[model samples]
Target: MKFGLSLLFIIGFVAIHLLSRRMKFVRMVPRSRFLSIVGGISVAYVFLHLLPELGEYQEHLYGDIGNAFWSFLEHHIYLISMLGLAFFYGLEKIVKHSKRKNSKKTKSSTGIFWLHIGSFTIYNSIIGYLMIREEFSGAWGMFFFFVAMGVHFITNDKGLWEIHKEDYEKYGRWLLAVSIIAGWGIGAISEVNELIISFLVAFISGGIILNVMKEELPEERESSFTAFFIGLFTYSILLLLL
Candidate 1:
C-alpha cells in the first residue's frame, strides 16, 4: 500500500514540473498570491515538520558515529543545513551574475541554464528518494509532504521559467521529471546508511528554506504578505494537528 501511494505521489510531483508553466495565474507581476502562499507553506513545512524530523535523525546519528571529530559534527545537523542553504545561494548568485552579464540576451546563457537545471535535478532527486525511504508517521505524513513539495515546485518552476524561458519548457522540466523517477527507483532498490539519509534531510530542509525565501524576499517580487501568512498559519495548524 505504501509503495503504491509513493508511486502516486511521484506522479504528482512529475506533473507539477511538467505542467507548472501552464499555471498562468502564478506568473503575475505582483507575484501571485498563490506563489507567495506556496512560499509560506514551504517555509512552514521546513520549520514545523522537516526540521523536527532532522532532530530525531540527529539522535540516531548520536548512536552511529564514534570518531571524536565525527561525533562533534553529528550533533550539528544544522551545520549541514546551513551548508545546503549556502550551496543553493551560491548557485543563485552564479545564475544572477550570468543574467546581468548578458543583459542583451533574452534568456540565460546555455551554460547557465544547464548549471541551474543540473542542480535542481539533483534537488528533485533527493526529494523523490526521501519520499520512499524517510520514516513517516503514516500516509498522512506522505500526503503533507506531497502538498508542501508540490506547491514548492510551482514557485521553483516560475523562477526557472523567468530565467531560462523557453529552454526550461523545452528541456529542463523533462530532466527534472525524469530525475524524480530515477531517485525513487534508486530508493526502492537500495537502502543507504541512515547517516546519509540524516544528512540529506538536513540539507534539503535548508535548501527548501533558501529557495522559498529567495522567491519571496526580492523587492521587485511585490509578494503578498497576507497570502503568505494565510498559507503559513494554515499549514502550521495542519502540521500541528498531525
Candidate 2:
C-alpha cells in the first residue's frame, strides 16, 4: 500500500509540472486568488507540519551527535532550515537581477534558465525522496502532504513560466517532472541515513517557505489577502485535526 501510494504521489507531482502551463486561470494579469491560496497552503504546511517534524529531527540529531562541537550549535536543524531559505532567496535575487539587466529580452538567458531549472530539479528530487522515506501517520498524512505540495508546485510552475517562458515549456518542465520520479526511484532502491533525511526535511521546509513567499509577497503580483487567509486557515485546521 505504501509503495502504491508513493507511486501515485509521484504521478501527481509529475502531472503538476507537466500541466501547470496549460492552467490558463493561473496566467491572470493581477495574479490569481487561486495562486494566493496556494501560497497560503504551502506556508501552512511548512509551519504546521514540517516545522514540528523539524523539531523531532532536531531531537534525533541531538541524540545521535552528542559531541561538544554539535552541542555548540543548539539549533543546527533550524540553521539548516534557514540556510535553505537563504539559498532560494539568493536564487530569486539572481533571477530578478537577470531580468532587470535584460529588460528587453523576451526569454531569460540560457545560463539563468538552466541554473533555475537545475536548482529546482534538485529541489523536486528532494521532495520525491521525502515522499517515500519520511515518516507519516498513515495515508491521511501523505495525502495532506500531496495536496499542499501539489498546490505549491502550481505556484512554482507559474513563477518559472513567467521567468523562463518558452524555455520552461520546451525543456524545464520535463526535467522537473522527471526529477520527482528519479528521486522516488532512489528512495525505492535504498534508504539513506536518518541524519540526512532530517537535514533534507529541514532544508526543504525553508525552501518551500521562501518559494511561496517570493510568489505572493511581490507588490506587483497583487496577491489576494483574503484568499491567502482562507487557504491558510483551512489547511491549518485540517492539519491540527489530523
Candidate 3:
C-alpha cells in the first residue's frame, strides 16, 4: 500500500514536471520544481504513512499537523541542499577567480541536459536491478526513490543552473540534493509489489521521452513508426531487466 502510493506520487510529480509547460498553469505551479520534488516526497509521507493511521474521524487534526511537519521537512531539505549548493557555489567562485579577462565566455546548452539524462538512465537501470530482490521491502522503497530522483534529474532542464550559469555553480549540486532527498524519502515510505512499482515507474519514465520531445528536440525529434519501435524496444528492455 505504501509503495504503490509513493510510486504514484512520483509518477504524478514527474508527470507534472514533464508536462508542465503545456498546462495553462505551467507558469503558476506556485513553487519551483525544486519545491515540488521536495514537497512531493514530504507530502506523500503524510498521506501514506500518517494519514491512514489518523483514522477517518479525526482526519482534519492529523492532516493539519502532518502538513506542518511536511513543511518543516521540506524547508529543512531545502536549507540542507542550499548549504551543499553553496559549497559548489564557493567552488565556482574559485574557478572563476583564476580566470583572466582574456578567457573566453562559455555558453550552456542542451548538451548539459543530455549529460543529465544519460547519467540518470544508466544509474536508474542499475539501481532498479539491485533493488528488485525478493523479500526486501526496504530495497524496493529505495528503488522508488531512485526512480523519482533519476526522472527528476533526467527531465530537469530549466533552473538557476541554466539561467545563471557561471553565476551559480552550485545549481547542479542543489538539484542533486533535492533529487536525492526526495527519492530517499519516497522510497523509505513506499510499501508495494515489484510489478506494480515497475509499471508505474515505466509510466513515469515514458514521460522522459515526452520531455525530450517538448523541451530538448521540440522540432528535430521524430516520432515515426521506426522511432516508436525503437522507443518501445528500449523501454521493454529496461522494464524486463530492471
RMSD of each: 1.0, 1.4, 15.1
Considering only N, C-alpha and C atoms within 3 Å, which residue pairs clash in candidate 1? none
Model 2 per-residue lDDT tens digits across residues 1-242: 98999899999999999999999888535978998888899999999999998888777667566677766444677888999999999999999899889999987789999999999999999999989987988999999999999999998888898898999999999999999999999999999987788778889999999998888788888889999999999999999999
Q: Identify the superior model by lDDT, candidate 1 or candidate 2.
A: 1
Candidate 1 weakest lDDT stretch, 10 residues: 66-75
Q: Which residue pairs come into collision in candidate 3?
A: 2-191, 3-191, 3-192, 145-183
Across residues 1-242, which tens digit of lDDT does each residue of candidate 1 receive?
A: 78899999999999999999998777746898999899889999999999998888888787578777777767798899999999999999999999999999989899999999999999999999998998888999999999999999988988998999999989999999999999999999999888889888889989999999999888898999999999999999999999
Q: Which model, 2 or 3, shows the larger lDDT?
A: 2
Better of 2 and 3 by TM-score: 2
TM-scores, all models, native as reference: 0.97, 0.96, 0.28
Return the lDDT, model 3, position 235.
Answer: 37
lDDT digits (tens) for residues 1-242 of candidate 3: 64454445445444543443344432212323332333233223223322232233133233333455444432233233234334334433433353433245453333443354334433343233323221334545445444434434433434324333543344443444344335535446564543333333333333332333333232332223343334344434433353
lDDT of each: 0.91, 0.90, 0.37
Candidate 1 is scored at a TM of 0.97
TM-score, candidate number 3: 0.28
> Candidate 1: misplaced stretches above 4 Å?
none
